[model samples]
Target: MTRLGRIIQRFQSDQGGAALVEVAITVPLVLLLSAGVFEFSNILNTRLLLSAGVEDAARYMARCSDSTWNNCVALGKNLAVNGAVTGGSARVTGWTTAEITVGKTSTAAVDGSGTQLYLSSTGTVDVVQVSTALPYSGVVFWDFLGFGTIDITASHQERVVGW
Candidate 1:
């Protein structure tokens, strides 16, 4: 066979692990992305729940002027139990220097402000923080290839929404 033909024959007879090489390079990257996506989705779900919980707490407080801080906390906890909010911790606090308060409107107006039992606002800030640690099992190929679980910590504050 001619040199070119001989080269072609050699090429045809020899096998190259090109696919494995490509996969080795691409698989980890894909897995990393998959892990990130999963973690982000989990964080988003947690945020949605926290937001709803805080909103519910504020709503309850706005309506129930006679309600105490404990009462608002209970409202938030109960709302969370409905499964609208999942993962992380939740609590309600009111009237802190670190927080902004709008006194009740219907209730006796808080001095210095005309607002009473209407809707007092408090900055939930870190007071209502939810933290979730998620473990992403990674992509199917990555996990099978030896990649381990990805750990993610998602945290956020829930603001008090009055009225």
Candidate 2:
């Protein structure tokens, strides 16, 4: 056999580089999957935190007294962004009170039979809603992956119960 043919045969039969080839092919895939899991978890955690903060603010505003109603809205916005009535660090990075919206709504409740269930004489229930749309800034570069400007939106509503 020719020398080049013998060399080619030996190279083709060699298993020494097979493991390296497999690792090279799989390493990036494994890393990408791991990074995806981490990113998803991070997003989920941020969503949960935002939801909790919104719920807390809504509950606070719902139970606020009529006399303190003026301060309730501001405090509720603070709570939704900072997780505290007073100004403090935000629950999520880059979150701010500017992103939060606090509002009161008058909604009618109905049972499964479609009959109105009104507790107040006005036939409408007062609801406090807290909401925010926060832009997600991930640990990795999401924009590079074509996931442009992901926003995490959360909202919560609680029935008004004044003291």
Top lDDT model: 2
CA lDDT, every prediction?
A: 0.46, 0.83
Q: Candidate 2's residue-wise lDDT over 1-163, tens digit each?
A: 9999999998997889999999999999998888888888999999999999999989988887647776888888787778788867878888877898888878877656878765666656888888989898676746557787789999988888874
- In model 1, the runs with Cα more than 4 Å from the true position are 1-15, 65-73, 80-163
Model 1 weakest lDDT span, ten residues long: 93-102
Task: Return the TM-score for each candidate structure.
Answer: 0.42, 0.87
Off by over 4 Å in 2: 66-68, 111-122
Q: Enumerate clash totals for all models, in the order shown.
A: 12, 0
Q: What does candidate 1 score on TM?
A: 0.42
Cα RMSD for predicted model 2: 2.4
Across residues 1-163, which tens digit of lDDT does each residue of candidate 1 receive?
Answer: 6999988887786658778889999998997878777756754664455455445544554444444755555444454334322344433221111221222323222434544422345312112443333444544544665767754343334333342
